[model samples]
Target: MVGYARGVSRVLVSAVLVAAALLLAGCGSDAPPVSRPSSLPIPDGFTRVGGLSNGLVMAIPSSWRSVDLSKTDFEKELEASGLTGATLEQAKTSLRSLQKSKALYAMDPASQQESPDGFVTNLNGFCQPSVGASADALIEIAKQQLTSVNAKVSEAASVPLGQGTAVRIRYTLPLGKALINGTQYYVPSDKGRTCVVTLSTDLTGKNALFDQIGGTIRPV
Candidate 1:
């Protein structure tokens, strides 16, 4: 299970969002009326996005332009992560396997002004070592890699996502004079896999797309 966490470790990328607050700010476009179940109402301008190779799909604000990370250092980072052919292929497979309402957007370390909230949020999937693993273990894995000062964890419990349940991880960090909060709702996926949806924002709590976004995850 720990090994899985290591591979799914980009959860740490979120730390970049919270940690930066020690320095300074708080943190999209258009598209279709992607029909959803009555229970899951997608807000206006929330466009469907996903990886072409991976079946991963999800709805993001249509106002937020599609960020193509493939051309960015993202690929280099993945390569440098020490993932070999088989492991890399498996990782790709797990993500592409997602059917609907799963998305990953590009996070630009350099440009923060382009995004509405001065933050980048994303959705993704990973192959896990154990499908039945506990939420605490996964959270701990991310926490160990995070260098947060006076971090406090809350709402660490199972919550419904789409047709399945996810471990909702909410935590706060004090960076410089700023208060940063991050949330990750993790779901175990098919054939020992995990899916993660993350939100990173300042104490202002300005983003409102997540609640509508959460409902689009189709039950596996």
Candidate 2:
């Protein structure tokens, strides 16, 4: 089960970076200029994140805090997120991974308060070069990758996102005795890359909130 978790993590992290077969797409600092304060409709109880030269705009729950590893004080960020000790180390590792991939990351402040070693509900996004693969094809590749790792894939389809459409996938994977629920979106961008957004959590009932957040993703 630990292996399965590692596999799933590899698949998701790869999606944040290289994404097997598909070329990597950069975001964050390299993103195109977006309107000040964002022009997209902010969901109720959610705050819009990403801007300035970043290539995407997204909304996360108001209770969640977006992470900017480059500028954020790691130790302080973890404390504010209610993490400490080994959990802080784990989160620090995750944040470094996201930072290295140039991805945008966010998490619920109390996500790790209860289960110290459990998966934290979080959202992250990055981009991969389309390389001619359509959204449907990209999603299939993602599906195959997860299934290869024995992850249970429960959903895959193209869904509306912002002004365009994206391929969305929902899956569950075992981690020790727990199950991790995850949702991913492959959004084609005008910037010649496919933005891959992911929402992952241990909580099973956050899909509605995940959908609400994913709906706000738009290539800037």
Candidate 3:
């Protein structure tokens, strides 16, 4: 299971949105949409986005972009975690294994396990680093940074990975004095060193986004 949190406080939503959009567009797409899902209301300029390895699918408002985790500093941290015999390629392999398994665990941190107003679920897969440091350490650093963004932990749980544990944490993002939802997953390598998959994202609506994304996530 993954932890989730929500809060209501003014933050640079526009900036965050821009950053997210830029990240999502890491791989450019020029083809126009052939069709839109009739069941779902596609926001203006919304584009289809999917997790690179997990095949997790979601639609981001054109204003929002998909970020490639591999290019971020987080990737470097995963590599630095010092997982024994763990390499970027091997870590990706492990991530696919987790996705296929769909392991269950809590998403909220241990300190904030009582609140349950938002959505949470364990994303099936491990995270792989393309380059950089240990993934697990990067995630820890991310957690600390998010706390400054007025985010709070909703749940936290651990799942078994090759030689490490997958840690899931749900954090609440506060914007305009309103609680915005988000979840993050950190899958460390077998040696419990670096994270294979370190994923986090905002819960668009009651985790509707998560459900949409999760549906598309498949093991690479």
Superposed model 1: Cα runs more than 4 Å off: 1-10, 13-41, 52-55, 70-103, 106-131, 139-149, 217-220
Task: Give the alpha carbon lDDT tens digit for every residue of 35-69 in model 2.
Answer: 22345778778888775334567888888877654
RMSD (Å) of each candidate, 1 decimal: 11.0, 8.6, 17.6
Find the 10 residues in a row with the least total lDDT in model 1: 25-34
User: What TM-score fits each model?
Assistant: 0.55, 0.77, 0.33
Candidate 1 lands at a TM-score of 0.55
Q: Distance (Å) between predicted and true CA of 200, model 2?
A: 0.9
Count of clashing residue pairs in every prediction: 16, 5, 59
Selected candidate, larger lDDT, 2 vs 3? 2
Instruction: Rank all candidate structures by their lDDT, best first, as comma-separated numbers.
Output: 2, 1, 3
lDDT of 3 by residue, 1-220 (tens): 1211111111122223322321211000111111122333344555654333332233443433233333323334334433224233343333332333222111212211222322112222233322233334444555666676666767654433222233445567654423445554443222212222223333344355443333222222
Question: Who is ahead in TM-score, 1 or 3?
Answer: 1
How good is model 2 by TM-score?
A: 0.77
